[model samples]
Target: MVVYLPSLTLFCDSLWTKKMCGAVVLFVFMCLTATTHADHHQPCHSPNMTGLMNVMSLKGDKIAQGTFAYDSMGKKLRFRSNESYPTNTSLGLDLLMLFEEGIFYEIDSKNQSCEKKKLQMLLHPLDIPDDSRFYTTMTAGSASIEGEGLKINIWTGSIPHMKGHYSMSVTMGCLPVSTFYFTETTTLLFSNMEVELEIKDPHLLVVPPFCHGEPVEDTPEGTVNSFLNEFM
Candidate 1:
């Protein structure tokens, strides 16, 4: 049942359509700046609720790779994101977050250190039709994938499932193109999905033993903001 990701060290994780953690951050930002940020418009349909899966996202020269695992019965997720920047040094950021426990771990792969902090939020994408202006404009079309045309629903505006200005694609049966979506232009592609799969790795739910890092004492809001400020 464990899908071995041979590319885990490189961009194996970040081919998702949306950045799950980024949306969690954006939702917080939207809540904080509600007075300044207007809805893209409103939706006429029910909002989309997120469950979990594995996906990758590509944006400009930067690459965000992550694995989003969810336990629907338990109502939480085990996730990680590695964002790579196009620099001579090829700087990158690696992270891991476990819901339900409210633990956020930032892994310094090179230094082999990790920062653990207490932070928790129900990270799920709920895109109400009116959450953004373009929610109503979402059009359903057939996108050719691997020479096969599949019926997909596409929308522009801030991502509906999570938050941010990304185009989103939803396949039939209400499955999101990936686990995350933002910027309609950021392409979200799927590599694997185990909707009925539950996370079994205990290590994924806690800080690794190899990293000698201390836990940070902070509120969920405080810790989440600190984590977001780095990339957002």
Candidate 2:
């Protein structure tokens, strides 16, 4: 899904909330001395985990809340959007991307159907890109006491060959808190995230039995552009 905002482009892939390969631009007005730097936070990878994710398109005024699983070791990603506005856009959409097998499955539990397509891109690990520059460190929540807040690190960079820029925020522990993808006209925000170091339910990474033996077709459409239509 792509949501257009002034001077921003937010693109999200079905496999991972559609911001998979989008660019990132972070505009901060704090101290230059604090904003411009590189450090141990350069490229921190997230461990295999499952968590809740809230995806929002600023200009489009669309929102989808779902659970997502990231298994870096297995090179698999699964997301099931159980709630969404305008119901037909993403609600009840379950997607599984198997990078090792070079395939993806779109399972429709209501109809007991599945669409198997060849996965087109290489694995995009959940981590701060090596090229990312340290933007700044800030506190996440408002608190009366100076020390009573969550410390977060902001990183900024652009995806090579991709239009626009990207920004991501992670806790001091390197857990992803939110990510922003910006392009010429869209702004995509992935926020209200709760990530754990454990998969919680291993079954989420399993291919649904209904999708077994399903013929794999060439990618009918790019996963990044078909997010909104998946629910239809």
- Whose TM-score is greatest here? 2
lDDT of 2 by residue, 16-114 (tens): 443433322232213112333455555676678777666656434335667778887787878788643224554466888786787778888889889
Mark the regions of model 2 whose C-alpha exceeds 4 Å error after superposition.
1-40, 83-91, 122-126, 142-147, 160-162, 220-232
Error of 2 at 27 (Å): 11
Error of 1 at 31 (Å): 33
Residue-level lDDT tens digits of model 1 in 77-156: 44454332233322255556554466666677677777776653333332223333332212222233453333434445
lDDT on C-alpha atoms for all candidate structures = 0.40, 0.60
Question: lDDT winner among the candidates?
Answer: 2
Provide the lowest-lDDT 10-residue window in model 2.
Answer: 1-10
User: Which consecutive 10 residues in model 1 have the weakest lDDT in total?
Assistant: 1-10
